[model samples]
Target: MIIADLHPGLPFFLGALVVLVTPLRYRWIPLLLTPLLGFINLMGWELGTTTELTFLGFTLNPVRVDRLSYLFGILFHIAAFLGILFSLHLKDRMQHIAGLCYAGSAIGAVFAGDLLTLFIFWELLALTSSLLIFARREPRAFRSGTRYLIFQVGSGVLLLAGTIVYFNDSSSLLFEHIGLTSTAGWLIFLAFGIKSAFPLLHNWLTDAYPEATPTGTVFLSAFTTKVAVYALARGFPGTELLIYIGVTMTCFPIFYAVIENDLRRVLAYSMINQIGFMICGIGIGTELAINGAISHAFNDVIFKSLLMMTMGAVLFRTGKINGSDLGGLYKSMPKTAAFCLIGAASISAFPLFSGFVSKSMVMAAALEEGYHWVWIGLLFASAGVFHHAGIKIPFFAFFSHDAGIRVKEAPTNMLFAMGLAALLCIGIGSYPWILYDLLPFPVSYLPFDNTHVIAQLQLLFFSALAFVWLKLSGIYPPELRSINLDFEWVYRKLVPTQFSNLVSAYQRFAEIAHRLWVYSSRRLEVAGRRLHGPDGQLSKTWMTGSMIVIVLLTLSAVLLKNLL
Candidate 1:
């Protein structure tokens, strides 16, 4: 049987069983094994084995492997392996197990031949991934995890509903080539939109990412949104709406990241911005653009994970992730500083960095597709990326003002994880063809052309110049002592206050209405008692039974005469 013919259900079922049975001390072993198994199943997989099986009258594919699916599945396994390795030191088997199952489900969804299978794995990802946040056990973590779960599971529901509509309309369950005009397609798009961090649906990312455990954040960064991006590329490629949405997504978050206090949260905004690039690539819809998107997705998972790992290590060691509280850490943590700088430079698209290779492909595709304005917007966002992630993250945390606090370097495992990710970042950057060859389409694009390289260098240098100029002028927003309100404030603060005020007004109205009702009830009861009283006109029976009998006899006689 082809690798595509291998059943995903077996792995998912076995993974959950192993997770349940495996002892806590050795849980990482099984966690590590599961992804290996998935990787084995994914590598060298033959395309187009879209088989359907009916279990208790519910159809499931068990195997739906294709080129697009294989790309996502392979990366998800890589992410899972790295994530498990990164978290091996932690004692939380619950998180480890949940994360494995979550990764498995994401891989499963990618290979799902039909919407039903997709929805199953889709909900599973939400359920399992939320456990990572809840692993912290803080009240804030609990609340944020709950909110995150609601949005995630709600997205799955929308997908399922869309699937039902799709099947009803087309009499087919296959999940392929959905359009925006149909209800099913629109629902599915919105479902993907939520997880993909489309515009207003993005607050959960920035809200909950910072609240997760240091290791948990690394896992959080890789899988969920990127899987959604893959799904969009799979199910709704070339949807024009994504172009506008992607541009908006790219531009808005820079300001937020610039003004934000928390370093992890800053990365979260930057993540959304990067997703916008991929979305734009998908929207452009050429073979080259799609390949660029898929290639970028692969590179993004590596470098983004590396960046989060560095920040996670920072939080793990110093217990300070806020920009205002952290600085001058290179004195003690040179390795961490070095890894962080690599991650920053990679994200900033520095020459011979991973981002430069993949990001340029997307930009080139955009320009080639005649999206001149979008290309310009993407260029600005590129500079802004350098400003926030490149300059703000590393400079403030590692080399800026000395806060007079000395912390040890990250633990051995943390450094190992960061090193692994950094190696991939540099390896991919130095040789773009290594990634380009793995794209869904034949590789015709070159990221190292003179024009592209010169443009990128100019952009990076200019952005750096801007950062230095602002710093020298003392005009850059100083690290704040307070948390600037983000989109979450709408739900966390503004809505709650407004809801309380509305409830108070309703309570006042209810009190007045209650008094009126009680008064009216009491008056009616009094009226009833008075009407039923013996002294009342209706209650006073005059002449009693004798008068009633005489009246009956007279009426009977008059009726008889009229009948005659």
Candidate 2:
């Protein structure tokens, strides 16, 4: 019997169903096994469209196994596994099921060769991932989850509208590069940009990710934005505007990272900065640049998740994650601290680290593309990331003055998750070729050249020195409980408050109008009583002569009309 290649999403989605129905005692088996199954199935895919369907005269390829899609499939599968491992100790079935479904949707989206199929998976991603946020069950989680849902679902709506318009205009459903030369394409691009967390559309990520349950944050940090990156790289590679937009993404987040009080929120800002690098690389679109973009994305999932896992550990242990509220954790949770440092160094792009290999490719590509200024901005961003994510995160949480709070080490499962992530960070860095070999394009770029190493070290060390100087001079911004304003203020604060005021005004107007209506009705009732009620005109007796005269006139008019 010939075995057919399975859809990359099947393991995750089917596993989710099994998880939902299986007895609690045996529920964990599927979580542990699902990603492996997905990975195995992904490896079996044979480099082209594998499954197709025709309905209503539309050709839909449910499985399109190309380099770009395949790469993303691998990443999603791996992420699902790590996410499951990290959450192993939790008893929340909703999280397990929702997270699996979310991963499945992302995997499914990548394999979709037609817009319709991609749209289905795209919306599923939004729905299932949002559940991770709501699973926290806190009121704050609920509110943030709602905002997250609105933005994400809104993106899906745009995607569907754009797809329909594009299909109508072009009479093609093949997913390929469609630059912003037409209405449909621009709509689709904007939809992708929103998911990618382009500058103004970015607040949802920082706002929502920090509010998610710890394990949920790990999953959130991995899939949603990366899918956008994949879509962009897939659908609009070499678009020149992305370079400028990507630069903006890189340069602006550093300021927020420096001042943000919530440590997880700082990581959120840092994520945007890192994604900026990838976007810029994708914009370049040289083989090297595209490889850089894809590899950096891969590297980011591991290190960023590691960082989130550590913060989650701290949150899990002491019930605090704010920099202002946490300190001296290395004293108790040394293993976690070490793992966090590895993640930190990797993110910082230190020599012989995962980030060092992938990020260098992008920087080198930027220079090669004659985007000299863009390269400079990315260079600055590199240092800024280290300043915030690499140094500030570990320093404030682990090495700073003790908060006098002592806690036990993270649970075994959490430690295992961190350890696995840490191993990947080291493994990828030590052997860059493992990741390089998997790049969607052939690799010619080298990250370990003497010039590259020296230049990166100088930039990173100088940035570290600035941090030290600022700290010694007492000029570094201290973590504050009061929130700083961001683009989200327009939605999270200003819009809601404005809407509340508008509603109050409307309610007051309704009250006044209601009172006027009541008064008018009373006056009309009084008039009726005076004129036509029991004691009024119609009820009173009239003189017989007057009544007869009236009746005679009425009869005369009627007789005249009939004669005419």
Candidate 3:
């Protein structure tokens, strides 16, 4: 059998089983090697008829390696490898197994040739990724994992419901663009929106990610949301509503990120903000715009995971992830600090950074599509991303006041992982053509125009200058060990508190009713005893005789009146 003929994701599932059965000391062997095999298989397939399976009268395509899916598959495979390298020191077999399965499911989802197959892999992605949270083996992590699983599985449920409805209506289950012209399409759109973290449905990303284990957070940061992005780009392109929704997602997260004390949570909020740009590009639905969204997704997975891994290293070393408790770490972990700066610059879209190359595509599309108001919103969001994700994260974690916390550099394995991600950010940014070539569409946009570069620099530099001014003038909000409420307040705090209050009210009403019942019963007993008890005059013989004499007098009076 030609190895190239195997499904790209088959290697991961097979590898996960092997990792589970392998001895503890040897488990990393499968962890380190599977992605390479997966990548090899991924690259070997041509553009058509890769693999398929027939199940229950549905023509399920397990492998359809088109340009669009291929780009995502390659990116995911690379991310899986880097993730494995990052966790090489870990002996937790469950995490390794779950991580591999999670990666495999994501690959399967991307390459799935039909809605039915995609949904199958989509649900698997949720199941396997949630296990990563549980592998942390902490009570808080367990709770977060449970909540995360709800949002995830909920999305899959919606997809399944939508799929049923769609099949009933159209008698087809192709995973192509099903626009919002019918109920089925709308359900699927909402399902995609939930996973994409669109506005009100978004708290899951920020709520559960920080509570995961450090390494788990790195994997958590990369795959799930981006997969949603892929689905949206494919399914809801030019849907118009996405543009407004994306704008809202972009602007809302920055405020929460600014006030957030947990550095990991800050990154989580920033993840939504980054996705907003992609959503907007998809909304534009032009070749250039869609290209921008895909390339940005690619860039986001790398840099976002890089920052997450860096923070994971910090948490691993210091046993703290809050910004209020961390500072001056550059003194000890210079390598990590440097790598973090690269990730920051890349995220900030500084010239010759990966973000600079990709994000520009979206902004330019917004302008060319006559979305001037939307363009303005995106520009402001761009600066806001730099303010919080780019500046706030690094400044507070590495360069703020000396907190007297000293720790060694990140582990060699971790440093290796971070190095790989950092290199990609710089590499892709410096040479846009290499990434552009991988885009689903041919490259037409240029990143290095004198006018465009100058404007971007001015915008970013001014944003940085504003941050410095605020810090020096004592206007910037100080990081505090306090929770900043977001949409999660609706569920985590408000709903629970309201339910508790309702229970209290019910108890009070029940107490009052019980007392009233007792009082009424006592009154009835007293009244009954006064009328018929043995001590009463009416109950005795004298009362009977008195009643007879009164009846005789009444009869005599009635006879006299009749005679008159």
Candidate 4:
């Protein structure tokens, strides 16, 4: 039986079961078990069993299990396994349960047959993943987690709303080709956009990622954005607007990253840069482009997680993640330094690395599609990746300015996890077909062509040369202590500050008005009392019994005279 043929409901059930039975002491057990369960489900699925079903008025089918979703699903499972292994030292059961559920939901989502199924898993990812951020228990972490949840859950809501509109307009909930001209389609696109770290909507990433626990960052890096990329590919492939958005997403983050002091936050920027490539590929919408996007997603999960693991390990040991306070640690942690370098090389698209195999596909597709400007933007971002993530991360963290803090190597589990990921990075880079065969489309394009290899080498080598020149000439910006603001500044500072000022002004105006109203009303009440009192002019009366009798006698005489 093919793995995609297995019921999508099974993973959710098994994941929930794991959450229930796994104890706090062995919380990591569930995290470890989840991927195995996914693997089992994968093995049990048959291509023929891929079918669609409607339940609770929501159409769901595990219909598509082609190479694209398959590659992502398999990588997600692998990432979960590695992430769980790295996080074994974490005792937070909430993080453990949430991580498992989040990973499982991501897997389920990739295999989902329709929009409704995707939305269910999508929302679940938001809920569960936010818990990982909150697990840090820091005030910043709590606050950022709330923001993160809002953005994530908001994406799901948009997706749900779009699904409703789609069903209302089209009278169908089947997840198939969706055009961007309709309301429902745009809603879905925005929904995926939020997850894909679209410009302006992306602050949730840099805002929240660095706030997660050391181990939590490793897990955070792999799932959320990749899932969004997958959803975009599934729902909005070939949407032209994405090309511009993708370009913006890639270019603008580099400035902030260059100035960022937090190494993890810098990686967060690079994450967006990488996603831009994938988005560009999807926008191109050719078979090769789509295949490139999926393949890059596979490579990204591995190397990006590997990079995060290095940072996580460093933080785990030293409790410091700021780039300014770190340097020259490669002397003490040579193994870590080596692992980080491998990750850095892979991210930089060095020849014989995973990134070289995967990222070049997108560039190739762009050039093939005659998207010259798009290709140029991606090229510059690729160089920028080498600057911020490929070099800056490892350099500042391990080899730049010695902060004179000597820390021990990462714990055993952490090292093992990093080692495993590093080995895979090299393995995949050495033999591209190991991953190429699993892409959604047939493997017709090769990453190792002589022309492609020479061009990539030239691009990367020149970028490395630029970095060296900048560093040696003291032209590189020094990492600073103060936070450099981004889109989150709008929510974090600007909006709130404006709102508070408005409320304060309103409160002052309300108080003055209330006082004046009270004074005027009291004066009116006193005047009213005086006029309506018993001794007032309106209350005086003058009726005597004798006068009444005289008047009655006169009236009687007049009445008798008139009658006669």
Model 2 lowest lDDT segment of ten:
1-10
lDDT: the better of candidates 2 and 4: 2
Residue-level lDDT tens digits of model 2 in 1-564:
022367778778889898999887887788899898778777777876558799788988888888888888888887888889999888899999999999999999988888889899999999999999999999999999999999999999999999999999999887889888989999899889989999999999999999999899999999999999999998889999999999999999989999998999999999999999989988998999999999999999999999999999999899898999988999999999999999999999998889999999999999988999999999889989999999999999998989988899999989999999999999999899988877898998778888998999999999999999999999998888867899999987799999999999999999999999999999999999999998998879899999999999999999999999
Candidate 3: segments with Cα more than 4 A from true spot: 50-52, 532-564
Model 4: clashing residue pairs?
A: 1-45, 2-45, 2-46, 3-42, 3-45, 68-440
Which candidate comes out best when scored by TM-score? 3
Q: Residues 190-216, candidate 3, lDDT per residue (tens digit)? A: 889888999989988888889888999
Worst 10 residues of 1 by lDDT: 1-10
- Candidate 4 residues 1-564, lDDT tens each? 455545543664566577667777766666666678768777665543457676886656745676556767788888988988898787776776777778878887887877888889899889888988999998989999999999999999999999999989988877777869899999999999998899999999999999998888888899999999988887788988887888788888987888999999999999998898899888988888888888888888999999999998888888989998888889878888899999999988888988888888888888988999998998899888888888899999999878898988888888899999999999999998988877777878877889988998898788889989988899988888768878788989999999999999999999999999999999988777787677765566756986799899999999999999
What overall lDDT goes with each candidate model? 0.85, 0.91, 0.91, 0.85
Give per-residue CA lDDT, model 1, range 86-195, as digits (tens): 87788776877777777778887888888888888899889888998999899999999999999999999999999999989997887788979899999999999999
Question: How well does each candidate superpose onto the true structure, as a TM-score?
Answer: 0.90, 0.91, 0.95, 0.91
Native-vs-model 3 lDDT?
0.91
Candidates 1 and 4: which is better by TM-score? Answer: 4
lDDT of 2 at 162: 93
